[model samples]
Target: MGNLTNAVTIVTSASSGIGAATAKRLAASGARIVLAARNEDKLKGLVSDITEAGGTATHRVTDVTDPDDLKALVGLAEETYGPVDILVNNAGLMLFSKWEDTAVGDWDRMIDTNLRGYLHAIAAVLPSMLERKSGRILNMSSVAGIHVGDGAGVYGATKFFIRGITESLRQEVGVGSGIQVSMVSPGVIDTGWADKVSDAEGRKAANELNKGAIPPEDIADAVAYALDQPTSITVNDVVIHPTN
Candidate 1:
């Protein structure tokens, strides 16, 4: 991995799960981390933990569904650590149910947080990155975006959009700008995301899948790999799954 000593990074949904793990991992690698999430207490706790471990980190309570909050997150990173060398759009929600039984509100929440939220973050940070002519944007997509399943129709749609947008941005940014856009698509993993699964059968199946799921830290490692690559090399997409 290339040196990340002076890189400044912003990681959204960073209070827990994969986002939190990624923040810690990057900080350990010597990046100054700005953690954003809706939960203030958890975010503060994470910052404390990272600092105690000799990693530099700070937190901001951010609701990714709001564009202003996304803008504030990027601005905060700049105020504290200068230009953000990397931005990880990891904030997302997963609500699963059969198409016929799904609630409209749940569908809307998934779309807003999982899809629109990523777009908002990108819009917030793109101009600055363009001006600097160097940056890395990492979007947290999922394997569900690649394979259609019975209960994950809307959720998968959002992730698929992420994949598409990341690729499009990668092309739009071009090689001369030194901006790398990448997406990490992870398989089933152990996380509180299952808390939103209202279907009994879906919950049961998800629990079974998570029994042998990859750790959140594994996905963090994938993020580190993408960010640690030489500035001239871009890892367009990485799909990580548990061996089991």
Candidate 2:
């Protein structure tokens, strides 16, 4: 149970939900946090909370869908706290709609924010990690990635892509490189993501299923567990679901 003291950790979508909770927990464990999300005000609030608790923090307003923004995110981490020791690719969208309904905009947004954004974040930090041979990348997938059902087709595809890349990256990095890659799959966590469901039927279904959903901190705990582990131990493919 090693602490993350002085670790330069970047968390995307850190304004709320799992990202925000994870930032708080990591900051409590003594990690210097770099928060990135679309919400600058929320990011500032988080920075204030962390700093008030005696934890160091910085923030950037980033859109994960943009390569430039992600590059700047990693750049800020480097300039502020040296090379990024860890990256939590947490920014994502879950615009659930029926496949046959032809929600092209929703699908495109998902591809950009969920799939392509994940790639961009990795590409931004990987070179330095490769050069240093020491870093961690933890991508947040969803249980739907492994088990797809109604209203989850496109979203599931994105999570599956994340899982695939996480595995591929871990192996590509090889052993003795000191780089760790992990994936987390959380089921039905309580967050504003549910409201993003545009389809009437899909939104109703999601709302019904999300009843009694687990708190975001539960997923955050899983992230903290992975990051706190030794470099030799990569906590990969964590699946967390509510018992109720």
Q: Residue 51: error of model 1 in Å? A: 0.7
Among the numbered candidates, top lDDT falls to 2
Report the poorest 10 consecutive residues by lDDT, candidate 2: 169-178
Tell me the tens digit of each residue's lDDT in model 1 across 47-150: 99999999999888998889999899888888998988889999988877777775678789998899888989989999999998988999999998898666
Q: Write the per-residue lDDT of candidate 2 for residues 141-212, one digit (tens) a residue.
A: 999889986888998898889888888898888466789998889998898777888888878878887797
The clash numbers for all candidates, in the given order, read 0, 0
After aligning candidate 1 to the native by TM-score, how far in Å is the CA of 180 from where it should be?
0.9
TM-scores vs. true structure, each candidate = 0.96, 0.97
lDDT of each: 0.87, 0.89
Candidate 1: clashing residue pairs, number:
0
